[model samples]
Target chain A: MNQLLFFAGLKEAAGTENVNMDLAGLTVEEVKKKVFEVYPSEQLQTSMVAVNEEFAGQEHKIEEGDTIAFLPPVSGG
Target chain B: MNGKQVWVTEEPLSPGEIISRVTRRDAGAINTFIGTVREFTKGKKTLYLHYEAYPAMAEKKLQQIADEIEKQWPGTTTVMAHRTGRLDITDIAVVIAVSTPHRDASYAASRYAIERIKEIVPIWKKEHWEDGEEWIGNQKETKPGVPTKEESR
Candidate 1:
């Protein structure tokens, strides 16, 4: 299982801050697909993902116990 | 023994505390900038400001800003602390302090740090006005005499 965290605007849009995905050896894209399946109305198209605190693209593979974060573009000063 | 020191907190920030952190015997010039919550905007009375951030990314971006300053000005000490959560009027929102042997370097680095922070850091501020609260984000194209919603449209 992997722990996923969402922050800022993404959290507000998703309506939940964090979730645990029980998909071992799945790619990041697969995880994102699961998220979309769970929240079909969510605006996941514009969000970005991070793995282990580093910005990651969709192709990045996820291992067991990995920490994933979904982030929306932030506007802060 | 060198490089930049950074601290990010949800507690209210104090300019005096930040100043004490970077002060050293070798530094001759220390420049600090404090961002505060204002009382009025567009004729609306503000109640408070709420700040939020992507903790990991914010900390990383702050470190990069400090590294850039160090490269531009050698032997410079920089400290930047931004507050999160709710803040009332007159509360310190952000504090940036830079120390250098000369005033020019201190001023330059301090200015650069604040500008870059506003540009790249993932922190958002929501202004709570008497009537309502509005989130201010991506002011990249803000212009005079243009209403925010009209501009978006």
Candidate 2:
């Protein structure tokens, strides 16, 4: 199972902190698209992604057991 | 040898402590920036703010900021501390300290550090207002007049 995590505003938008999915073989972009399909947010289209805690490109592949996060534009100062 | 000077603490951030971390006998000037939770933003009354982060990744990015500072200003040491959890109006949210042998480098490096943090750090903030609450994720948040998911219902 792959673990998906959410943070901050995304957490409320995701409605849960963690999710388990069988996302193996899917690219990061595909995984993100799936998330948006499930959560259905317009603002989410602009979200960035991270795989295994590192910022990942859209084309990066998601392997078995990889944790993914949809980071909605960061606002830290 | 260089040391890790970046930190994410739940306790209130102090510019003094951050400055002390980067201070050395060879340093001539120290520059500091403090981020505070203000009572108003764009005419809205902010009751408080809640900050959150993916701790491990947040720290890693902060370390990257420190490294970038050293690269840009040789002989400079930078330290930054960010606080999490709920904060009231006027609370200090973040403190950045940079020390160098000269004032110009110290000032420039300190300025660069804060902007870089805003651009790259994985931390986020949710602002509580009198009428409603808004999670400010990115710098380009839409106008305050828009309703949140809860409000839109």
Candidate 3:
């Protein structure tokens, strides 16, 4: 099972810090689309994805038990 | 030494501590940028700011920024520390410290560190206002009418 993590606004919108999914051979882009299906939000549309502590692109492949983090637009100093 | 270069802490950020990270016998100049929470944004009276980060990734990107600064300005070392959790107005939010043998390198390196953090760090902020509150997007972009889960209509 892969865990989908949400932060800040996305966490609130999804109503949970994380959700579990059976993601096998799914590209980051595919997983993103599925996330939208599960927890649709306008903010999630623009949220960037990260896999294993690195910013992941739509084309990046996901692995088993990997942590997929959905980050809303960053606003750090 | 690498992990020591960047941090995400819940303690009140100290610009001096960040500067201490780079102090060395050879360093003759140090440059620092301290970012503080303000009392107002646009016209809204900001009550406070709530900050969060993908901790592992935020620290990773902070190191990346430090590395980039080292490459661009030889002989310089960078230190970046960001505060997480709720921060009241006038609180110190972040500090980027750079040190080198001279002023020029430290100045440019410090500038590069802050800009790169804003562009790449996986951090988020929620602005609490007197009337309402909103989560600020990448680079603090705020949009009206977008509802949080609690207030979704």
lDDT of 3 by residue, B27-108 (tens): 9998889999999777779999999988888988888788777888889988889999999989999998888999988878
> Best by DockQ, which number?
3
lDDT of 2 by residue, B1-153 (tens): 224588777887767766778889999999989999989788989999999988887888898888888988999988888889899999998899988999999889988888777767789999998788887865745332222332211
lDDT per residue for candidate 3 within A1-77, as digits (tens), equals 89889998999999999888988689988988888898998777788777887777777889998988888878988
Local distance difference test, candidate 3: 0.82
Q: Which lDDT tens digits does candidate 2 get at residues A1-70?
A: 8998888777887789888998999987788788888888765677677788777776789999899877
- Candidate 3 clash pair list: none
On a 0 to 100 scale, what is the lDDT of residue B139 in model 3? 59
RMSD of 3: 6.4
TM-score pick, better of 2 and 3: 3
In model 2, which residue pairs have backbone atoms overlapping below 3 Å?
none
lDDT (tens digit, per residue) of candidate 1 on B1-153: 223366567877778878887899999999999988889877889999888887777788788788888888999988888888988999888899999998999989988888777665667788888777766754554322112332111
Pairs that collide, model 1: A76-B123
> iRMSD per model?
8.1, 7.6, 7.0
List RMSD in Å for every model shown. 6.7, 6.6, 6.4
In candidate 2, which residue ranges exceed 4 Å CA deviation?
B1-4, B140-153
Question: Per DockQ, what order, best first?
Answer: 3, 2, 1
On lDDT, the leading prediction is 3
